[model samples]
Target: MRVINFAHGDMMVWGMYLAWLLATRLGIDPYLGFVGCAAALFVVGLVVQRGLVDRIVDAPHEMQILLMLGVALVLENGALLAFGPEPQRVRSALTLSTFWLGPLFVDVARLVTFAVAVALSLALYLFLFGTDLGRTIRAAADNAYGALVIGADVRRVYAVAFGIGAACVGAAGALVSPFLPFQPSAGLAASVTSFNIVIIGGMGSLLGAFVGGLLVSVAESLGAVFLAPSLKELVSFSLLILILLFRPAGLFGRRAG
Candidate 1:
């Protein structure tokens, strides 16, 4: 669970493509098709974790980095071959809808996205805290050897955890498909943004990651408003630098011993 998933963004790209496929072929909207995408990516995560990551669980950090990087490259290239290089966006009726609340006009698609994201986050929180499997996962994360000694299937737990993480990514990809024009090459930027959020929030801290995402999003939006839209990323990176300088452990992250 502590493993750095460098392939995450590429995996999300696959989710996007899967949603696109469903939308075009079956006439399923991305919003509705996201469930299938999540389920598919869950399997992908399980296979990757069980077949590849398990073997290198105890390897050096560099090895883990290289392994995921390799996986990312493979996924990216695979998407390129399958989907070609052109950017794709999923079509949905909600994309054309908007509502005015108070003095603000909000896109319906984005509103739905925000609502679903919150629901997913809440569901994840409940899953991790209120369920037996969730407790076991937390235990395994805290002390794998202890969990193993207690007869818990640590490997399976890890696999499931990875699967759930991947599923979340897939759902996210599908949710954004209506608005974000994506191609295989887009994975790099997505990965970079993800890394920025994680680092800014603090590694191994879920709350940090959540808050970090909000902060980063707000920063980017503000950047787009005040600066050149193309320079929004520059604002994100600048915030990352400031966070790294002032709170390397992240605002909510605990200092490592």
Candidate 2:
């Protein structure tokens, strides 16, 4: 999407916090909180898009980035105020479980999270390529003015795109809640990594993002095990720098004509 949502990481944290609230207070399983988390984030995305994002859609990129950065600060600080600075954990049966595949062992929670991520990604791809709403969103993203000229509801498309993106963040939060600690700034930890993946894979290309993520994951794991653990992030960051210098449009991204 062309919409620059710098607050996306914070939105993910909000989803994690909401799921934690449900799990801790309502006795609901964190795994089962995926639905609620996604729904809440979808609504939040809608409100944020309508109230803030829509106004900046046609503005300069710098203005849009600053606005979203402001939104991110508000979200982060609001989380700190409401939940305090303490880190929280969501308890689940799969938290400590493991599965073995011959000589390999995997954390069950992490495995499930991976599976859910793939499934959701596939679902999103299908929706984007197979549904009318998806086509509308694509049209708007490709050419907002042309979309308007064609009588498409550009604003509505933008709103829906934001909602879907927020829902994706919520789903990711839900998937990782069992293993990752939830805090006001926990999601921020992944912010830089997310940017690297998008840039490496090619912005606006789902398959590129997926492949870039996998490459980063493998690089991090290999670096952690073979090199100093402290150097894992450095490896990925180096990869990002290489990508930027050599393939500015990304491995899969096409250069604009």
Candidate 3:
């Protein structure tokens, strides 16, 4: 499903809102409520893929980009209307709990978030490499025509791929909701950050994306510690520029044949 989802961050914002809703209205913790968010976004992905993306699957790249941009706009505005412009943060007991490790205090919320992220990444890796559906998805991504030749339902594969991607985003939103304050306008920043991570890691490579995210996070942390906190983003952008110049294919992405 080689689709560039410009709406990814907006979808994540929706997931945050959903988790917030559950927590405030239903008393479900964001940690456990993330499952519901993921499931809901999975359906959203299916609807967007089938209703909008499928209509222009073969269109030019410009059309695809515009379509996604349009989707992003819609999601952002919808969120603003529904959630208002106030930044929201989910309150969690885990976020308040902390433990001392040596001389430093460790945040339980951050630790849990890291563990969940790693687990999800591993699960995604296993699914892609070990399951038939995952393999089919990879094949379709590599060559849609070849997949179709082998009697695969390429459209369905695309739908599932998109759904899974959205689910991942939703889960991520819920996971970070405990600490990150978010609003509709935050989606743009999140989208940019995501692009920086993907580009630094290597597009089309899950390992690259995972490593890239870690690298970016580490770099930002170092930047904030060594320089100014406000300059952290500058460091990330500088790294992105270097990667683009030296390894345009990305750290793990294959070079174009």
Candidate 4:
């Protein structure tokens, strides 16, 4: 995923933040917040893809980056205007009540988060691999020109894929909303996390994204437990550097986009 998708870290953090905020402030459950946010994000993604990214599907990669940057700016500023500049948090009932499992401390929230992430990943895989529309999406992703020649609705596919990706971030936000502090600018960190996962896992591969998330989460957990809890970012980036040095193609992939 890392080899293909750029900036996954950002996505994870942003989504998680949204989930955290919605649940804590509105008296809703985290999972409920996740569902609502994902749904909302799906709509937002549809609009962004249909209204913006769709227009530049044929644009050069560098141009696409520029376009995304512009959109990021708008979203960030919009958050600033609407949510203000302070860090915000939602109430999640999860606590440090850990179970001593024969020498390791396990937090229930972490376990739950992992479980939820896995379930969501499975759903994403099914959506991508289980139906006719999924095949068209894959085809369009592979080659827009060929897809267009074959009568594939490339634009529609683009919209759906982008929508799915954005909605994933939203679900992420709503899931861990109860456990952290967030601000509009938190998206920057989320972007960084997603970018790391994508690079470490491989690009354009959902399986890569899933593994990247697990690997990075494990690494982060280990770092927090053994090293300075403050060194989470430092540790994560160090692992990323090692992975890139030894297997530049990514943990589960070869080839790049």
Candidate 5:
């Protein structure tokens, strides 16, 4: 999830950055560019599921891996052709400014990202706990066969839930785009981060995702201040290794095969 977040932001934001830069350099308001990129990727994510994910659901894990690797190949090469083989960054709204918050100083952009992440997490929690659809989703994720036996339309649930996960990263992408520079092939790194978050939080637990995202964010934040910024990735997964070594069931996840 973290990696996906990074890739989404890189493409969405990096793409937006380039578009805005080229246009503004030629004299245009970058807000228009930002909106255009955001809308485009929202549509792309929606289409990605409709086109790609739909075909991969029942495939073996290895097949899924092959499909994703192929998709990455096409996407990266296509981007290189379209956007060129250079990395680029924009003047981010997420500057290195600190805000005093009742005894803690916070990075403004990080703070906003955390706030948005938390709100989304809360919304997801309420969806699972408070809504019928959310209940169905949980049931389906917990046991697809049982859900189907209970007449819950398991396939549709899978489609919708996968769509939601993908879309979550899409929205995150838009939010992060104005904050980071991006390269065409950055999704690989983003995918790593997403996997780290998923592993740390415990799979199949929404609340874990919330807490896990926050923990990763805080760790990365503190790590960069005291250690090398480049080591954040190692810090994240190393912590994950230690946690899983002891907990195995994730910090909050139920144990399952």
Candidate 6:
């Protein structure tokens, strides 16, 4: 989508906080809380889209960027007020469980997270390629005016896209919460990481994103082990710069006609 969502990272933090609350207060499993968090984030995305984004869909790009930035600020500050400044860690049964496969030991939480991520990605691909609503969304993304001319409800599709995007963040938060610590402003780093991934993989290319993330992860891991841990990000960015210099459209991005 052409939409700019600066608050996306904050939304992930919000979802993490929700899952944390459930885990700590209600003794709900983190995996189970994912369901509620995803649903809530979907509603949040729709409300933000319809209430704020829709109002400025046709506005200048600068205006849209500024608006989203403002939303990001509000969300970050609101989280600070609501959740306080403390860092939270969510512990699940899966956190420490691991299995040995030959000489390789696999973390249960990481493996399950990977499985869930793969499943979601496959489902999203199917939705985009195999369903009418998904096609409508693609149409709107490719040509909003043309989609409107074809009687496609562009705004509705946009809302759905936005909601799905938010829901993804929620799912990611739930998956990572098992091992990652959560803070009110952790979204800042997440947002940066997401931007890097999108740029490296080619914006709008699902397969590219998956591959790019793997590449980045490998680079980071190697850099951390071989070089100073603090230089991992530097290594990744250096690689990104090299890639951009050669492939300006990104590894998987095709030039739009």
Give the worst 10-residue stretch by lDDT in candidate 2: 186-195
Alpha-carbon RMSD to native, per candidate: 1.2, 1.4, 1.1, 2.9, 4.4, 1.5
Off by over 4 Å in 3: none
Q: Predictions ranked by TM-score, top down?
A: 3, 1, 2, 6, 4, 5
* Candidate 4 TM-score versus the reference: 0.86
Q: Find the number of clashing residue pairs for candidate 1.
A: 0
lDDT of 6 by residue, 63-118 (tens): 88888888888888998999999998898989999999999999999889888888
lDDT of 4 by residue, 26-51 (tens): 77767567787787787777887788
Pairs that clash in candidate 1 = none
Q: Which residue runs does candidate 4 get wrong by more than 4 Å?
A: 1-26, 93-104
Model 5 lDDT at residue 129: 85
Model 3 sits at a Cα RMSD from the real structure of: 1.1
Q: State, as a TM-score between 0 and 1, how close model 5 is to the true structure.
A: 0.77
What TM-score does candidate 2 get on C-alpha atoms? Answer: 0.95
Q: Write one digit per residue (lDDT tens) for candidate 1, span 1-257.
A: 57989998998999999999999999999999999999999999999999999999999888889999999999999999999999999999898999899999999999998899889988988999899998899889878999999999999999999999899999999999999999998887888898899999988777888999999999999999999899999999999999988998887878742
Q: TM-score, each model?
A: 0.97, 0.95, 0.98, 0.86, 0.77, 0.95
Clashing pairs in 2: none
Regions of model 1 farther than 4 Å from truth = none
The residue-by-residue lDDT of candidate 3 on 157-208, one tens digit each, is: 9999999999999999999999999999888778788889988888889999
Whose TM-score is greatest here? Answer: 3
